[model samples]
Target: MAQITLRYIPFKTDVAFLQIKQTEVSGIPLYIIFFYIHVYSAIFVLLAGFTQFNSYLLKKRPTIHRNIGRLYVFTILFFSAPSGLFIGVFANGGFYSQISFVTLSILWFYFTLKGFTSIKNQNITQHKAFMMRSFALTFSAITLRLWKIILVNLFHPAPMDVYQIIAWLGWLPNLIIIEYYLYKQSKK
Candidate 1:
């Protein structure tokens, strides 16, 4: 996430600094702004989410946990998810990629909202379940990059083709695995 931030910080001045060439050509200033917000807030989401799951911190200093949780939710709801939805329509790899991103953005927002409301209702188990779902979606940022590297570098698939696959692969597996884990935990 830090690497992405460092790479993108210069993009404010130089559109050439953009990693995705397609983004440069599409170059609507509004889209650029939203994309920047999405990327930046995503980093915060990742950072805030890291501490959120720390059992020791959560148990010992729940106030801190709640604070960070609030940050995470706010970042996603106000910045990340909305920007993501805006940028998603212009995502590369055509309609498939666009659909994947749009759906992911919506689901990310939905799960995070559900988690927040569950906690507000004092339903800890439901809150945790929804949060797990939300974070699984959040982790797609990492997974997407990883899949890109592997698919592009190793197999040398066409970038658009690999992107189409990774768009869904990125979050689907994460969500599936988390659901499985949640199911198992519930059984126990």
Candidate 2:
């Protein structure tokens, strides 16, 4: 994640490095602005959210946990998700990839909101379940890159083909895995 963040820092000045479809978005001022918002906020959300599942942090520093949770929720709702939706429309792999990304963005927002409201309603279990779902989407940023690397090296598919697969593969599997984990945990 830190490496990704560093890679993106250069994009602040040189959006040419964003590459292909993303670079195409650079011409549209609004899209470019939203792209930066999406990237930076997503990074922050990912980092802050990583600590959220730590039992030790929750047990020993509840205030820190709550604060980070608030930051994660706020960042995703206000900045990351909306910008992601915008950028997803211009995603690389035509309609299929666009749909995948847009769907992920919508689910990410919905799950986060549900999690927030669940906790507000004092439904801790529901809150945890919804948040697990939300973070699974958040972790898509990482999984996308990992899948891209694997697919590119292993199959050497065309850029669009790889993008198409990773677009759906990224978040969908994460959500499925998290749901399975949550179900098993509930049984316990």
Candidate 3:
């Protein structure tokens, strides 16, 4: 009986270890790799953009602001936006994911352009304000990922189903938040 018990113990231990390994390998590596890049880059841009905005607001340093803003816009407009759009299109979900990304692209363009035009017209205040909204939207990339996580855990464990809603979930909430804040600022 003791010999039989010891033999089964090793078998059980091996099976348990194999189960743990399989569970760890359950996630798709390719998706995770791209996601890591997408997430980290988006966060970097958001943090850096906010720092530049704060500097402009407090010091009113046009030179530093303009330079930083230019860098920010270039990064978002060219690199971040394009990459996001691509990932959005290839997103594990379907129509929802596509629409969400398309919306992000448009808003990013519109707000950024408005900010640029405002600056051209020598309307620094308006430019700054509009740019704030644009950058907020840009930062939505991060929010979208977060929403995807919550939705996956709560409503849809499948990436595809969650992907569908997250397309809208990502930016729409951010926009709503922007609107709400703008409204509050107006009241003040």
| Backbone N/Cα/C clashes per model | 0, 0, 0
After superposition, candidate 2 runs with Cα above 4 Å error: 10-17
lDDT of 2 by residue, 1-188 (tens): 77666776766545443666455565676877778899789889998889999999889998999999999999999999999999899888899999999999999999999999999999999999999999999999999999999999999999899989999999999999999999999899
lDDT of each: 0.89, 0.90, 0.65
* Candidate number that wins on TM-score, 2 or 3: 2
Residue 67, model 3: Cα distance from true site in angstroms: 1.5
Q: Which residue pairs come into collision in candidate 3?
A: none
After superposing candidate 1, which stretches have Cα over 4 Å from the reference?
A: 11-27
Give me candidate 2's TM-score against the actual structure: 0.93
Q: Which candidate tops lDDT?
A: 2
lDDT of 1 by residue, 1-188 (tens): 68878777666634433556455436676877887898789999999998899999889999999999999999999999999999888888899999999999999999999999999999999999999999999999999889888888888988789879999999999999999999999899
